[model samples]
Target: MPADAARTDEEWTSLGRSVLLRQLALGARSRHQLDRKLAEREVPPSVASALLDRFVEVQLIDDAEFARMWVRTRIAAKSLSRSSLRRELAEKGIAVELVEDALEQVSDEDEIEQARDVVRRKLRMSADLADRTVREKEMRRLVGVLARKGYNPGSAYSIVKEVIAGAAADAAEGAEPEG
Candidate 1:
């Protein structure tokens, strides 16, 4: 950006492309995100659209690819449920179809396993959950945590029950008269 600027559409187009490329270089961004950035900078709509279209053509901007990557990393790293994943991508301006497709990567079984793992990990971390009252209160909290992460009530309840029961059985076995 200089005090003296060129007065040609070509110059504006180049500038827009530079801004867009800098963003793309940082990481994947939804089309909506990119458009908002260009708009904020007062890039002409036509120039922004043309440059964005060109970027799409060159595969520099692929919403579908971005959605897939987002789903993979988020699920693996955050253990987010399909419902949570869908909502997150939608917030990022990903298309419904793409979000659904990305969510397909997580199977129902996998989601359940993740839910179970979350409950187990949380219970293990809360050593104060020793008595029945404490366990019940902690179980409710655990179920709520899962529910907030998009787990269905039934799934969260069942997983919480299973983890608590399993821990009780382990404690019972371990409490046998020490020799």
Candidate 2:
């Protein structure tokens, strides 16, 4: 065993706290997630607990703020649905109430538009495919992508259809001979 592994529990605890502090400085993390990570790194339960408590006391690990930021980032980057976001927050160890509050800040219209934008961006990359095939494939692909991104099936389907139709129209127009 390494010399460090033979150290007393208190020494290990201090080392764990230092490592966890560095991790938190890099990005936000949920208490549960951090605990799990610390455990995986072989940090003792007592040490991890103390470190987590210190973090919470210092406001470095606020579940409420974490939930809000998580929702905002996911919605803005991936256009995920409230259901998906809720599930994700739960997995990250956030309370149900906090997740609900965070979700309240995201509107249905905003999610729909974000979903549309994702589909549009993906469609642009497949411009070489034939029109009808492209529309069909993109519709299915978009719906799946949005669903995985945490969008509801109904909303994902609706937005995918709209985006596919618009792309189809554009493709047809572009193919026509200029007058």
Candidate 3:
């Protein structure tokens, strides 16, 4: 039979299983994400749904697990705020309730530390510039960066100021004249 011939039911199931395995191998994905990807690959909805059910049954595919892992990875790697994480998870088709549960795992201290780290990194990047200009530019950049990363403006500003002040104090001490 030519390649274009419609696949037998068995062949369709086998193909879908292969595709689902490949997708899972890439990383954890929510059911919606998987469905979209499988559909994009031209898998019939029925076959895709069946394969997804099998994966779920075998514990190979899980939205709750995917949400937890996604939250952890994004927060650690990107220092994303809960808001940013929530938005990203939503965009990935995760349910809001699941996203909230995952976000709840991120403590306030962790978020503040992440925000501080973001400010420190930006401050370091702009270190060679003039102090006033550097502070102003860095404050603006850090605010925007944190905001984009899902932090509130007030928290972002406070963290940026704190980091910049610390950096300036350190620089001043290092520049002091020795006896």
**Each model's TM-score, in the order given?**
0.88, 0.76, 0.85
> Which regions of candidate 1 deviate over 4 angstroms?
1-7, 125-130
lDDT of each: 0.85, 0.83, 0.83
Tens digits of per-residue lDDT, candidate 3, 1-179, equal: 65624777678778778878888898888888888988876777888898899888999988888899998898778899988888888998888888898888889997898789877776664374346876688788879999888789999999888887888877777779987
In model 1, what are the clashing residue pairs, if there are any? none
Q: What's every prediction's RMSD, in angstroms? A: 2.8, 3.5, 2.7
lDDT of 3 at 137: 80
Expressed as tens digits, the lDDT of each residue in 1-179 for candidate 2 is 87767878888887788778887988999999889888888888888898899889999889899999999998776667788899999999998999999999978777777778888887755454456676567677778888788777887888888877777678778889999
Q: How do the candidates rank by lDDT, highest first?
A: 1, 3, 2
- TM-score between model 3 and native: 0.85
| Candidate 3 ranges beyond 4 A from true positions | 1-5, 125-131, 175-179
**Tens digit of per-residue lDDT, candidate 1, span 1-179:** 75324446787788788889899889999887898888887777888899889988999889999999998998788778898889899888999998888888888999999998888877854444458788888889989989988888888999898988888777777778888
- Residue 178, model 1: lDDT of 83
Error of 3 at 176 (Å): 4.5
